[model samples]
Target: MRFFEATHKYPFDWETVSLASFRKYPNDKTPHVQHVEVLNQEIDPETGVLKTERLIMVKQNAPRLMMKLLGGSDSSYVLEYSEVDPRDKTLTMHSTNLTFSNLLTVGEKIVYKPDPEDTKNSTLFAQSAKLSADGVLSRFSSYIEETCLKRFHDNALVGKLGLEQVLHKILAEKRQERGGAGNMAA
Candidate 1:
């Protein structure tokens, strides 16, 4: 098994970043992400935390040879669980690939929170993922893990760019709404 961890600072507030994180899919930068379906959601009455489970469909980025060996389709499913703590201004998510569990397992965790070091409105993003190969792929586990890790690095940048695109779009909408409201009052 191999693992990687990284951190980034999104020049947006925690609320904005957290909101964009949930809505970060379906962007041109990360076209691999196809669909997301909320399986369950609920709010804690006492703690006021929101919990949700979602299934995400994404295109598999495996090598062609690996794909042929596995004889699997291009699409893969991932199961994710997340929590939002409004009081703490934190959002956390955990996800695991479900399609090729017999041969490989990929698990990830991500967290978003207010940047403690940055007084200038920003959010800290931290993420980690573990990759492992088993069964038929065990012989090439190290190489597979290394390849996946390299891909993860590229995808991480793409994911952040996707979120930024979403956030920009949302901010523009907000600006337009405010402009419309001002015009209405005039």
Candidate 2:
């Protein structure tokens, strides 16, 4: 038997999801984006490079924005929020925006786990890519702009390992399966 401690409830901030979800909801009014202060940017001290997340930002207190994105037609309007606190922000949490449309359910519950080191903070965040509506691949690539992507050291092997390895494994399995199927047919 496995037991997990449930996290506390926090109103989901729709703004961060909204901008990242631009691909889902493209319109004339682009949610009035502004470059808010770089709250707590998650950086690798050893690499001297911004870690996996850097593009995400908290837009005040607009939890409804997520609803707008999830909801279609009538609910596409913008949701408002309060001022974003730089001190209360974190790159670990508010780093990548996800572009998922099916995540917005009216009565959906959001769970918040306060970082042990920073208790006063409650990020309207999902800890892992699998749990989040947007899968890991989409979320990871969305962080950097195309122009600057070249400068990043990790770009060279973007699809080399995961994709190629996956393909190689799939082909090998298919060959084995084909051989078995042919023998059975004979």
Predicted structure with the largest lDDT when compared to the true one: 1
30-63: candidate 1 lDDT, tens digit per residue: 9999999999999999999999999999985789
Worst 10 residues of 2 by lDDT: 1-10
Cα RMSD to the true fold for all candidates: 1.5, 20.1
lDDT of 2 by residue, 21-121 (tens): 22221222322233332333344455443422223222222235433644532222212112222333432322223233233111111222334554453
Q: In candidate 1, list every pair of residues with a backbone clash.
A: none
Off by over 4 Å in 1: none
Cα lDDT for residue 133, model 2?
A: 25
State each model's CA lDDT, in order.
0.89, 0.31
